[model samples]
Target: MKAPPHFIRNNEEWIIWLLEAEFSGSATPHALSSRTGISLDTIHDNFLYMERVGLLSIERDPDKRYPEEIARVNLTENSLRVYDELKIRPDPGDLF
Candidate 1:
């Protein structure tokens, strides 16, 4: 599906749209950073902000070894609804 005009207004929204379209239930800030070339700090901050705005949820990764702190991010139901409304989908040409 094609994303509607103004569906993604900025990099942060693009990241959220990407999460909703491609990652959904299994995403991490580090992984998103790797995928989108956005900085980890920016990803983390956006995750937190999105969570606050009820667009996504952040949870501690339970499978992490030792004391490393990592988060698993998931799009909330509201975010899924927004994605559906926007007809957002990953661009095959951009997948890597």
Candidate 2:
């Protein structure tokens, strides 16, 4: 399986994508930020970029009650292919 684009295959974004995939599209930007030590704004910005690149889908809450209740992020079909590739042969540094 071929890898994703360089930007999506990088550590930070890749980890976020992995986590979101693992959560079955229920992963929020705040959760990603907390887990990855990335700022909420940075996570949100990356989500938007990933969506634009066809790598992710971010569904904003229609209610939009709170700032933190933005939406859930999930990997797209194309992104899932990359996820499978990563699973088959993960980076050495990713082995924890």
Candidate 3:
């Protein structure tokens, strides 16, 4: 497995980890924000970042104009390989 890059943010990694078990590897930004106690904007940013890096595939209507409108965030095939190489798990603190 390829090693996860140091540039990957904790929240980004957490989002990927959560996606693995969410609706068969897909979920909406709102769902992820609610589950992680993170802000929707933050989730959107992470999603975009992952998407830019080829680690995620976002499903949305062609007319959708905002990241928040994303219908589903699916893990890319490469995501699992990177996840396996992740050496750190994000600390959820008391959010759990």
In order of appearance, the predictions have TM-scores of 0.67, 0.65, 0.71
Q: TM-score for model 3? A: 0.71
Candidate 2 per-residue lDDT over residues 33-93, each given as its tens digit: 6766767777776777777888887778887754455588777787777666655675556
Clashes of each: 0, 0, 0
Rank by lDDT, highest first: 3, 1, 2
Candidate 2: stretches off by over 4 Å: 1-13, 62-69, 90-96
lDDT of each: 0.68, 0.65, 0.74
**lDDT winner, 1 or 3:** 3
- What tens-digit string does per-residue lDDT give for candidate 1 at 39-62? 776777777778789988778767
Model 3's alpha-carbon lDDT is 0.74
Candidate number achieving the greatest lDDT relative to the actual structure: 3
**TM-score for model 2?**
0.65
Clashing pairs in 1: none
Of the two candidates 1 and 2, the one with more favorable TM-score, higher being better, is: 1
Off by over 4 Å in 1: 1-7, 61-70, 88-96
Q: Which 10 consecutive residues of model 2 have the lowest summed lDDT?
A: 1-10
lDDT of 1 at 63: 77
